[model samples]
Target: MGRARFAFGVLAFGYAFLYLPIAMVIVYSFNESRLVTVWSGFSFKWWQALFANEAMLQAAWLSLRIAFASATTAAVIGLAAGYALVRARRFPGRTLFGSLVVAPMVMPEVVMGISMLLLFVGSERLMGGPDRGFLTIAVAHITFSIAFVAIVVQARLTDFDRSLEEAAMDLGATPWVTFRTITLPLLLPAVGSGWLLAFTLSLDDLILTQFVAGAQSQTLPMRVYSSVRLGVDPQINVLATIVVSVAACALMLSGWLTRKKV
Candidate 1:
């Protein structure tokens, strides 16, 4: 009983450590004070300001579009990579290939951002196309996001029963049909989780976005960072509240989907 109580206490403390600041941010989102540290009275003025700020609104919308596109593109490519890693066991470069697939997950974001920046700069010099903007940021995000999705899918596939695929094939189904009808449904939970992770990563990213984002393509986080650098505006609190709400919804939806699929 004592040990159980101690464990529960630790768990509660851990959760408080993680969420207390977030709770404070949510509560202060309505504060009338311009300073985040001070709470004057509750007001919706900040929400109005957030809506009125055209630059911030545009940045937020652009960020969402980039995140959605990056997550989807990453999911597709990562799914194929993971499938190959699992199914093609006898390939010559199988070991190197597997290592490369997961390398980004462990790599530093700063390193990745710099590397992608250099790649984009070189590509521009060579092709004189796809300039530093939405396309570049989305591609950079997809590069890192792919590793995360590949890891998730690979884990799910590792323990999956091959008999299901084999059984479908024996019933005169083609490889594509078997994968679409039988294999994909079982892998939906992992894929959805990966997509959600990729989306969240793309949305919350700052350093990587900074390296690739052009002047006209600033994202919400970049906007917020610039604003906070000048001063903590009440509108930033409102923006944080909105972003947190959206992220929470995505997480809950992913959980529901996973449970339903399982």
Candidate 2:
């Protein structure tokens, strides 16, 4: 009983530690006061203000578009890479290929951002194309997010039953047909999860965005960070609340789908 009590207490404490700040932000988002610290009363003025802020709205929309593109690209690339890693018997430079794919996942954001910046600059200098903006940011996001999707898909594939594929093949299904009819369906949950995770990572990323984002390509995080430098406002809290709510919903949906798949 004592050990159980201790475990419960620790769990409760950890939950509070993580969520209390988020809860406070949600609560303050409704505050009537312009000042975030003091709650004047419950009001929708801040939400109204947030909606009225055209720059913020534009940045949010741009971020969403980039996230969607990045997630989709990452999912496709990661799925192919995961399949290659799991199914291929032998390939040239396999170790180097895997390491390169995973390098962005573990590399520090500052280093990754700098490296991406240099690569973009060099590419532009050589090709005289692919300027830094929305497209570049989305590509950079894909580069980092692919590793996450690959890891998730690889984990799912590692323990998967191979006999299922063998049986399909024995039944005269071609490799492409079997994969399309069986493997893809089974891996959909992991693919969806990877997309959600990549979207969230790209949405929350500020350091890399700052490095690659041009004057016209500000994302939500960049906008919010710039606003906060002037001082914290209730409008920023409102934005934060909206972001938290959306992320929570996505995560919950992903978890439900994964559970259903299992």
Candidate 3:
């Protein structure tokens, strides 16, 4: 009983430690103060200001579009890579291929960002086209996010039963048909999880996006960072609150979907 009590106490402390600051941010978002730390009664003025900021709104929309595109593209590529890693046991250079698939997950983001930036610039010089903007940012996001998605899918695939596929094949189904009708259905939860993770990563990334993004393609993180550099405003609090709310909703929805699928 003592040990259980101690463990519960520790868990409570850990949660409080992690969420206390976030709680403070949410609380202060409603404060009617230009001075962020000071509370001068509750007001929706900052929320109003956040909506009124055209640059912030545009950055948010751009970030969402990039995240959606990147997550979808990463999911497709990652699913194929994961399938190959699991289903192909005797492929040529399998070790090297597996290493390459997962390398980006552990590789330093700064290094990846710089390398991608150089690649894009060099490609532009060689081909005399393809400017740095939305497409570049989406491609950059996919580069790193694909590894995360692949890792998730690969984990799920590792535990999967091969008998299901074999049974489908014995029933005169083609490999593609077997995969689409049997394997894909069983793997839907993991795929959805990977896509959500990729989406969140793309939305939260700053360093990589900074390297690839152009003046006209600034994202919400970039805008928030710039605003914070000039000192915290009430609007920044409102923006952070909105982000936290959206993230919470996404997490809840993902949880619901996972449970329903199960």
Candidate 4:
């Protein structure tokens, strides 16, 4: 009883510590005052201002496009890689390939960003290709996002019953048909989770995007960074509030889906 109570107390304290600043930010987003510290009264002017900011709006749109494309590509590639890694037996270099697939997850983001930038620059120089901009950023996002998707899918595959797949094959179904009918249905939840995870990561990324994005390819985080560096504004708070709300909704939907599946 004492240990359980102690664990609960620690968890509560940790949660409060992590969320207190977020709660404060959300509350103060409604403040009417220009100053972030002083709370005059509640107003919706900041929220309106956020919508009115043309640069921010453009950046948000670009970010949405990059996130959607990168996540979709990552989900497809990761699904295939994860399925192979988890199901294939006695294949050559399987161990090395699995490690390579997961390398991005453990690697430092700055190192990955710099490496990707160098790779793109070298490619451009050699091939005399067009400049790297949105395409480069999307590719970088997809590269890292695949690692996340693979991890999620691999977790789901760990507990899966392989015998079901074997049963499908034994019933005279072709390998492709067995995989399509039996394995894919069981992996749908993982696929959805991976897609959402990839999208969220791409949307939130700043370091890698900073390295890869061109002058005209500003993402929402890059825009926010520039704005906050100049000075703190009420519009930033409002933007933060909107982002948090959206993230919360996504998390809630993921949680509900997970529960339903269970």
Candidate 5:
């Protein structure tokens, strides 16, 4: 009984430690004072200001667009790569290809960002095209996001039963038909999880976007960083609160869906 009680106490403490800062951010978001440290009174003025800021709104929209585009592209490419790795046997350079697929996940974001920027600039110079902008940012985001999607899909594929796919193929089904009918259905959960992971990564990214984004394409995090450089504003807190709330809802929904599947 004592050991059980001690374990429970430790878990409770861990949860509090994780959530306390988030609680503080949500509470201070309502502060009426310009100074975040002192609580003058509670008000919705910060939320109102956040909604009224046109530049911030535009940045938010652009961020959403980039996140969706990058996530979709990443999901498609990652699904193909994951399928190849899991299903193929005795392929050429299989080990090297697998390492390349996962390398971006472990690589430092700063190095990845700088390398992507240089590559885009070099391409533009050689091709005699317009300089980097939204397209560069989207492509950079896809590069990192694909690694996340591949990781998730690979985890699911590791436990998958290969004989089921073989059974479908032996029963007079073509390779494409077997894959579409049998493999794809079993892989749906992994695909959904991968897409969500990719989307979240794209949305929350700051470093890579900062390196690749052009003058006209500022993401929400970029705008927030610039604003915070001036000083902490209550509106920034309000924006953070909104993002936290949305993220929480998404996690809850994912949990509920998983539970339903089980």
Candidate 6:
């Protein structure tokens, strides 16, 4: 009983430590007062103000576009990498390829951001394309996001049954047909989970985004960071609430999809 009590107490303390700040943020987002330290009852004024803030709204819209594009591209590439790692018997540089695909999953954000920045700068100098704003940011996001999706996909494929594909190919279907008609449908849940995970990573990324984002390509996270530096607004709290809600929903859905049976 003492051990159980200790475990429960630790769990409760950890939960409170993580979520108490988020709960405070959510509650303060509705404060009627300009000063966040004091609550002056609830108000919808901040929500109205958030809508009126054009810079924040524009940055949010741009972030959504980049996240969507980056997630989709990462999903496709990660799926291919996962498939190759699992399904293919042997290939040249298979070990190196697998290592490269998952290296970002454990890599530091600062390291990745600096590396991506240097690559983009050099590429722009030589090829003279993709500029430094939207395209560069999107590509940077994809580079990191791919690792997450690849890890998710590789885990899913580890338990996958290859007999279904083998049976299809054995019966008169080509490899491409078997993959499209049989494998893709069964892998949809895992793919969806990976995509959502990648989307959240890209959307919430500020460190990496800061390195690649140009002056015109400010994202929602960048906007929020700048706003907080000047002083906290009720609207910043409101934006935090919205972002947290979105991220929570995405994570919950990703968990659901990951657990879904094929």
Best by TM-score: 2
Which one wins by lDDT: 4 or 6?
Answer: 4
Question: Of 3 and 6, which scores higher on TM-score?
Answer: 3
The alpha-carbon deviation from the true structure for residue 133 of candidate 2, after best TM-score superposition, in angstroms, is 0.5
All candidates' TM-scores? Answer: 0.95, 0.97, 0.96, 0.95, 0.94, 0.94
* lDDT tens digits, residue span 1-262, model 2: 9999999999999999999998998899999988888989999999999999999999999999999999999999999988888888589999998898788899999998998899888988999868899998999899999999998899999989889889999999999999999999999999999999999999889999999886778999999999899998889889889888888898899998778876
Q: Which candidate model has the greater TM-score, 4 or 5?
A: 4
lDDT of 1 by residue, 188-228 (tens): 88889899999999988999999988677899889889888
Quantify all predictions' global Cα lDDT against the true fold: 0.89, 0.91, 0.90, 0.89, 0.86, 0.88
Name the lDDT of candidate 3.
0.90
Clashing pairs in 4: none
The alpha-carbon RMSD values of the candidates against the true structure, listed in the order shown, are 1.5, 1.1, 1.3, 1.5, 1.6, 1.5
**Candidate number with greatest lDDT:** 2
Q: Over the stretch 1-262, how does candidate 4's per-residue lDDT look in tens digits? A: 9999999999999999999888888888999999988999989989888899999999999999999999999999999888888888769999898998999988899999999999888888999755777889999999999988888888889888889889988899999999899988888888888899899999999999998886767999999998889998888888888889999999888776555664
Winner on lDDT (1 vs 6): 1
Candidate 4 regions exceeding 4 Å error are 1-5
How many collisions per candidate? 0, 0, 0, 0, 0, 0
What candidate 1 gets wrong by more than 4 Å, as runs, is none
Over the full model, what C-alpha lDDT does candidate 1 score relative to the true structure? 0.89
Question: Model 3 — TM-score against the truth?
Answer: 0.96
Model 5 Cα shift for residue 245 (angstroms): 1.2
Cα displacement (angstroms), candidate 6, residue 147, comes to 0.8
TM-score of 2: 0.97
